[model samples]
Target: MAKALPEFAPLSLKELRSLWKKYRGNEDIERLVLEVQFSRGVINEVDDYFKIIHRTWRQENLGELIAIEKLRLVLVKQHLRQTVLAEIKPAPKGTKPSEPPEPEPALVD
Candidate 1:
């Protein structure tokens, strides 16, 4: 019998953006995000999942639980990107609001 594939649910765009804001400065979180985004299959294996979290924390010299939380945020962002893209609507022609673009982070420093 073929193994049943696990269902994967991506996070909402809002949630992903929030997580990015919260953890953008952490190198461990950055690494974890890359891993989760590129990993094959649904991430349903607990041991493998935790191992990634553990490795990231140890390599980055972060506290254990905090590292796990950061890794979770990465996963959330990956999921969000996948699921949220479909829901985003293009701005209507001429009717779109003309808000100023977000300022570059470097300009704020």
Candidate 2:
């Protein structure tokens, strides 16, 4: 007999909804929102944060650039995860139904 693979439990819609609501009103939420709106092309927040840290490091020599880089990587990953979750969560109850899906692309002759 073949062994069974481990079962994976996906998060409930309610839990995802709650998580989405918890972060929606936060000022930091705006960063993720901007990222999604811009289709991940913009990096203003990340660039600004790095610039400030770089300036501080230059003046104080308090930490190495590698340390700052590590921190920035962690923050960027977190922002991406939150943005994806927010996008996936369903809209609130009583809202109008969403529009129909976009038409499929046509093949070129």
In terms of TM-score, the best-performing candidate is 2
**Highest lDDT against the true fold, candidate:** 1
Which window of 10 residues has the lowest lDDT sum in candidate 2? 100-109
lDDT, model 2, position 83: 40
RMSD of each: 18.3, 17.1
Residue-level lDDT of model 2, residues 1-109, one tens digit each, is 9998784443333443454467766767645444343432234344445656667787996766787878778666644543454333322345322332232222111
Can you tell me which runs of candidate 1 are displaced by over 4 Å? 1-5, 31-86, 89-109
lDDT of 1 by residue, 1-109 (tens): 9998786555433444455667888878656544543341243233245556577668998755865767667665644545464242322335312332222232012
Evaluate all candidate structures by whole-model CA lDDT and list the values in order.
0.48, 0.48
Candidate 1 lands at a TM-score of 0.27
TM-score of 2: 0.29
Give the lDDT of residue 31 in candidate 2. Answer: 56
